[model samples]
Target: MASAEIGVIGLGVMGANLALNIADHGFDVAVYNRTEERTREFAAGAGELSSKIIPTGSLEEFVAAIRPPRPVIIMIKAGDPVDQQIAALKPLLENNDIIIDAGNANFRDTMRRFEELKDTGLTFIGMGVSGGEEGARFGPSIMVGGTEASWNRVSDVINAISAKFNDEPCAAWLGENGAGHFVKTIHNGIEYADMQMIAEIYGIMRDGMDMKAPEMAGVFDAWNSGPLDSFLVEITSKVLATGDDKTGKPLVDVILDAAGQKGTGRWSAIESQQMAVPASAIEAAVGARSLSAMTGLRAEAEELLGRPDLGRFEVGGNAAALLEQALLAGKVAAYAQGFAVMAAASKEFGWNLPMPIIAKIWRAGCIIRSRFLDEISEAFTKTPDVANLVMTPEFSRIVKETDTALRTVVAEAVRKGLPVPALSSAVAYFDQLRRARGTANLIQAQRDFFGAHGFERIDGKGENHGPWNMGN
Candidate 1:
């Protein structure tokens, strides 16, 4: 017997697709939107003979359409509207009914709402759905957080509807309380970093070697033969050859340098800072985006700025190939920064989120899904307690072997006056580790001069002391 008497609210692109997907799986689905016309249209259109997709005009009718203990999935915007929807649905749904918020919501808010609704005996699940509108209709990556009882109640529907990444559905029990939203939050952060990495590759190609889109696309395609193979890279090839919309211009030269960001990108940056994890690559990329969006100022800067000139690449030569390889290296570092942020958050929140499961979840449908995810998935499955993504042996080997070329790439980019934010940040991370400077020891010297702090002696002679005189 199929227990998929699921109802979906907010039939925007996401909700509409999700409803169709569930119906395709033989679930008796009842969908409701704010408008009657749309509700009627989609039902008439997608509710073919193969599937049953009922539509309702209002909340009462939508509620009435489903049976008791309904597993209603909410796909609307987060915050006040969600609260309002719950209030409206409260009058109709029986106690112990499970409400799943499949929208991208803040974890704290989910926790608060769960407690608020607990008294009514209605279960609230804060689920993070990724893979965009397409994934929602087919299968999307889904991260869930709530009480065990609430999660178990809704697990069957979620698993059946969610798209598969690798061999598993894009779903997991993230943790207790606010863990689901938190994990989703980090997932978005990783996505931001990954996208920015591909953009940096384009910039390096365009600036360092003056490669066009098609030319660079070919190189990216070639790179995709190996570890650098990725969804973003594959798409970059299409975006390049597709050209610009109005002018039929090669998109490389036609598109504006300006980039726009949604709230989640900014949120990820903010949260990483709060958690004290070095999300430098993503942060730098965000900064680069903000600067790019200031078009007028950027245009003025372009006029004022002189292009940097580079004579040659002597570090094993082959500047062109080296630039491409370095871009790949930066891609690795950007992912590292993102994983670091996630790891720190996981530790802070006590989520114990499985990295391999997450990597598998992202391998197919999400924006960050890439060939690299397979490697990560393997590493974490073997060693679930990985301290960082970069520490994995294969990843470390790739990085260490190519570091010289990677450094050369960043140097050339700096010389060419290109904005390779993620790339530059990536190289800086590698350099920070390569040279083990005792910055903390130097800090102690400064602290001793100002605050009379004690210092350790290296020579085994000098009293192990600071509070020495501060000379003008």
Candidate 2:
């Protein structure tokens, strides 16, 4: 008898929580892990949900437990490990069995895997599951990419286990092959930009204003009740409020400044560059992380260059309000860049991504979820082909009103000799986009003089060249 509705491989935190979520939603799930001890431990602690969970000792047992046209969800390390799992399952799966890869996989690899499994008559889906362990055990924002036929086979279960926005499932079939992962990569890239902007404002408040952590936490708590309301903002408040248990110091202060990344953010920036989209804010965020990793070099450089005296500066009254506005502006810039990248990718890949749907799905159960996204969804819904989010009436008004505050924050950081790359880049990008004509004509003239790169004339139709006299 076919027992489990689906089988989940790997008993890692995400996999375990997801299996439980499936079972909790009234679907029997068979789970397997490479180590039997871990599998046994999970089974032992499953409690009441244990009745709906089938703990299999081997891959064969796990495969056998599911019905024909079996749906297998793989949650493991991406790249080679994903390929290894697929190879292991190929022989076990019959025609039309579904294999969903739920990891932060590069889209190219997903496309290759999709092709590899096409001949075997098995369906391959590259899905992006956002939100962490808690969201997985409750509901996650699911982005799935596969054939419509394959999606039909498991859509019910997928939808049932995904977060909802206005009673609609947060999951959707973004496109075929790698579209889901591609969008997810962009999601993470935007997350990096957003976090960097917040950190920049925090630096201004802490170093320039000398504000205490609890005071900053109070400001963030207040922002949570306004347009900045989001998971990240809410958590920022908590993180600021929390103190180190050992020394009673602010936890963030005690923690190391170094940050780590898993490559998706870099990939998104690279893709945007390749597509010729100006995601300068995202690039700046990634560059800031890279620079942060050079702690030894930075310390040595600081010693050699001497530190700028910031003691005279005091970010006084209205600093919190100024920071709030700057954050909102930076967020608008970062999201505009992300959406632009996606728009270009959709056209390049023939994905026809639904921007409004993407915004709607991201409203909850994702790292960057915000009330701002609700406004973004409405903008797209009102005009699907809006050139940029900043140009949208709702966002434009906010940006217009907040521009002064953003400029004020950046100027203060500059005078204090603090690095505010993400926020500064956002302002630069906004200025560049808003300008009708730029100084780039001189660049074209320079290129034409040296390399005969050919420059287009504004007054005429054809490419024109200038005759340069070499001083002899």
Worst 10 residues of 2 by lDDT: 309-318
lDDT of each: 0.77, 0.91
lDDT of 2 by residue, 1-472 (tens): 7689999998899999999999999999999999999999999999999999999998999999998789999999999999999999999899999999998899989989998898889999999999889878988898888888888898988999998878888888989889899999999999999999988888877877788899999999999999899999999999999999999899989987877899999998999999999999999999999998999999999999987876634456777788899999999999999999999999998888889989988988888888888899999999899988888899999889999988888887888887899999988998999999999999999999889888998888887888764573
Instruction: Give candidate 2's error at residue 246 in angstroms.
Output: 0.7
For each of the candidates, the C-alpha root-mean-square deviation to the true structure, in angstroms, is: 3.3, 1.3
Q: How would you encode candidate 1's per-residue C-alpha lDDT over 320-406 as one tens digit per residue?
A: 567567766777777777777777877887777777777777787677777887888887787677776778887888788778777
* Best-matching candidate per lDDT: 2
Cα lDDT of model 1 overall?
A: 0.77
lDDT at residue 196 of model 1 (Cα atoms): 78
Using TM-score, give the best candidate's number.
2
Candidate 2, position 289, lDDT: 95
Number of clashes found in candidate 1 = 3
Compute each candidate's TM-score over C-alphas.
0.89, 0.97
